[model samples]
Target: MAAGGRGSGRPAKKKSPTKGTGGNKRRGLEGRGATPPAHLRHWHKDKARTERVEREERTGGKTSAARPQTRTRRSEDAPEYIGGRNPVLEALRAGVPAAAMYVALRIDNDDRVKEAVRLAAERGIALLEVGREKLDRLTEGGIHQGVALQIPAYEYAHPDDLVSIAQEAGEVPLIVALDSVTDPRNLGAIARSATAFGAHGLLVPSRRSAGVTGGAWKTSAGTLATLTVARASNLTSALREYREAGLFVVGLDGEGSVDLEKANLLDGPLVIVVGSEGKGLSRLVAESCDLVVRIPMHAAAESLNAGVAAGIALYEVARHRRR
Candidate 1:
């Protein structure tokens, strides 16, 4: 009491256990070790890393740091080609349908360009003309031969007609519908995937749908030749007709009530509707479905690309159909 302050109730509170723990040599060195100083932490970290890498190498295991990563640009399903008289003529003669065609009006009308125009019109493709600069952008500075045609986006078949036709032939009809998929590439990729998976045909709206075009054909890598494509006046009406014909129509949505795997897809003919790249199935289309199904995914990803999602759905449907 005499040594301590008279008014203090007790000795001043000692520092916290952790405060001077670092300074206590006996406690710090108890395990035949000393705490690493701040400057040496990096050294210890690097040493441990080096040791782990060496051990992995000796054991024939790869370390995370040892693998190099790479990125690759996949070959597009449809790629634009630029060439002059002979090439364009060859493409047309080879049965490549040009979606849109352009001619240089200023040039003296030549028979080759005239024939190009004739072929395009015969095939019901649009023809237009622009300044050389615009043609340059379209042809990427390649020989345009004063004529270029945007290739047809996709091959189409009438959904109703396809179903009836398939039935008459004693084969189950498989049709895929798109809600609002606008990207020509996606449309082409989906077509390619559908054809590859043995789907009968593809259906899209007359409006807001990517039509058969060169870009899509390129994306399909000539798969369009094997597929029948159909354009619907109104998709809702078409879906109704499908249901009336005893076909099961399923819509793919992230919040679907039925898991795709458990859905009874093998029972009969079916139509799989995939939403647009940006917005999924429109309200009317979603409401028209006999069932709404979803592919289970982890919490991390909100959704998948429309083309990829369509491919997966088609694969699942094909798998069941084959069984």
Candidate 2:
């Protein structure tokens, strides 16, 4: 074996020269572009914090601290489905605008189902036959009774639009406002009373209040279709706006000083505010009322349900206006 030459331990293999692109390798070796801002980098620890701070700034600190810093906008405008044979028939008879009628396959053809299908067909609504499992899923496990009606999301009018609606109708503004009322049935009942007694529209807070739902539609007996519902971001601010627009704001309270029947303001442009049955009027809302009036009732009654109170107040207002 040679000493300095290739030894018995195995000769070293010859290396081949690597080939290179014209300038591709150089371009790759060159400075990768400038680093992005920390918030733009998904792997950076400060990215979420930076984004949250920016979002807080953009939203004027109105963002929910308890929610995840990453926020998503949810669509509240999605269509709703009301189920049950009686409810479907009632909605159809009340002429509630329906997009479609879904009947479970081989469902019992009851009188209500037949009437609902006939009415829906008359209104040019599409009828779809689905499996019972599909109907259950569509109604979110509600007792569908083999039928369901697809209702479009209720389009709420702006708070200011109620006044304009009254003006266009050539009538003094008569509006009903609900404060902190979460039950859709109460909202629907109040709407029914409001419509019966000549209210131009109904007002509700955007939060902590009920918007039109299937329950509301069923409870209202379809009166919500004829009545306009307005949503306010802040109920107190909406009352102030109504006052500025020359409408008298009245709050229904058990402890009110004025009796609803004798209140002379009822004949004029009015806004009747009804509070939740449990909590009654909130401090800010009670303070915003031009007149806090009470319905005459037995002392043992404690407090009237919000719908009943609104109905009594609206009836008195209607009677007064008729005089």
Candidate 3:
């Protein structure tokens, strides 16, 4: 046999294990379960953050000094709530329905708290005196101010119902539509004006707009109970429909071509559309309006809040209708 061929396969070299290649750790099926990445953790802690967003978006839900501990559920079945002294008292005054009212044990015996208790008693709603910790859990760590109410989900109506409601009442319908008005307080103020001025119902876009939340309910001072605030899937289409239904569609803008004072459409079925504060009106919605009108204002005050402007417009409509 040849020397190289007989003994040789290059001295049969031995391979050494590489460092940091998971030499000692188990691999494949032998490995233990591992934690998911941060983004993949759907069960991460976000209850407080989520509650904060919802709290801020509420009509009167501005974050107050009283910070609450967050309690939340992923499901939509969880009941709605309003907390803090002013919120609870106003909600009670407005007669917002409540399955239960929770008062913290040894709460400050303040006037608003007293009024809330009295109102709850008068309405025959059960009162549950609970510990601060329990109250915090119930409100999901809101600034409860020793009081809270468990309320039903807000009920929304269809835009078409406004016209039908007016027809059934045998009266000229006056409707107010809000475009991108996201403040709950503004909604409440507008609702108050609508109730005051005999408006048939209110229309709000379903998206990018604030709904009749607890804050709005309390701000309305109970007028929301009698007023029908309808939801519109698309504002432009809703305005067009209002026009086709024999109701005049008027958009309110600071730079409108027509003055609201001399407007002649108040006598018939009408819808006064108010836009958002920052963005005024979207192009599509503005174009759909039959007349774009602006209220007269003196120099210095360039703009009014969406709510204040809506109240003024509603007053003018009511005044003209009465005349």
Best by lDDT: 2
Alpha-carbon deviation at 272 in model 3, angstroms: 0.8
- Tens digit of lDDT per residue, candidate 1, span 1-323? 55556566667656665555555886756686678886689988888886774444233343345454364221223334434655455556546766567777696677777776777778787878777765665665766767665552233567777786677778787888888888878887898788887777889898877776545655665676567788998999999999999888999988789988899964468899999754678899999999999879998988888889989988888788778
Candidate 2 whole-model C-alpha lDDT, 0 to 1: 0.85
lDDT of 2 by residue, 138-228 (tens): 6768888999898888999998898898899899889999999899889989988998988999999999898898778867877888999
TM-score of each model, in listed order: 0.57, 0.74, 0.72
Q: How accurate is candidate 1 locally (lDDT)?
A: 0.73
Return the candidate ranking by TM-score, descending.
2, 3, 1
Pull out the clashing pairs in model 2: none
Q: List pairs with backbone clashes in candidate 3.
A: 59-184, 68-141, 68-142, 69-140, 69-141, 70-140, 71-140
Residue 97, model 3: Cα distance from true site in angstroms: 1.9
Measured with C-alpha atoms, the lDDT of residue 246 in candidate 3 is: 95
Give the count of colliding residue pairs in each prediction.
18, 0, 7
